[model samples]
Target: MNGPALFYDKAAFRKAGLQPPATWKELRQAAAKPTGGRSYGLALSAVATEEGSWQYVPFLGSGGDLEQLDSAESVSALTYWTSLLHDGSA
Candidate 1:
């Protein structure tokens, strides 16, 4: 089945001296570490369409609910995404 997944370059991680991230915070930190020279730490689908929304489901699923779009968890998820962009991690 098609799904959201993360792909990493083992060599890149080794070169950056990073272990695979185990948590959202870790992922955020790691995302910036290997970013440079036309490389990005994470690539997200931000297009305004179903494909874009699909790419976000997994992240939101971790702490947010579509049913409660205004809930704290939802806000947090969005905030996290914003942080990633702001920090040049995505």
Candidate 2:
């Protein structure tokens, strides 16, 4: 199926002593590290526009359907994204 895919530099990951992330939590943890001095773990489009919301579709989907935006799954997904921002990982 078509979906979001993660692309990372092997050399960089090796240098950082990190393996490929296998889960969302793991990805978030990995993203939290090596972020400093203009370095970011992930590149996210948070602009206030349709494109910005489009970029977050995968994350929202992980939470569940759009019919229930306030569902637990949806909240969890949003919380995850917010954490990434708060931790300066994106």
Error of 1 at 59 (Å): 1.0
Residue 2 of model 1: what lDDT? 35
Tell me each candidate's RMSD, in Å, in order: 1.6, 2.0
Identify the candidate with maximal lDDT.
1
lDDT of 2 by residue, 1-90 (tens): 335567897877888888999889889878877788799888887789876777777888675666887899988888888888888998
lDDT of each: 0.85, 0.81
Q: Compare the candidates by TM-score and give the number of the best one.
A: 1
> Candidate 1 lDDT, tens digit per residue, 1-90?
339888888999999999998889899988999887788898888999877887776778677987887899998998898888888888
lDDT of 1: 0.85
Assess candidate 2 and give its TM-score to the true structure: 0.85
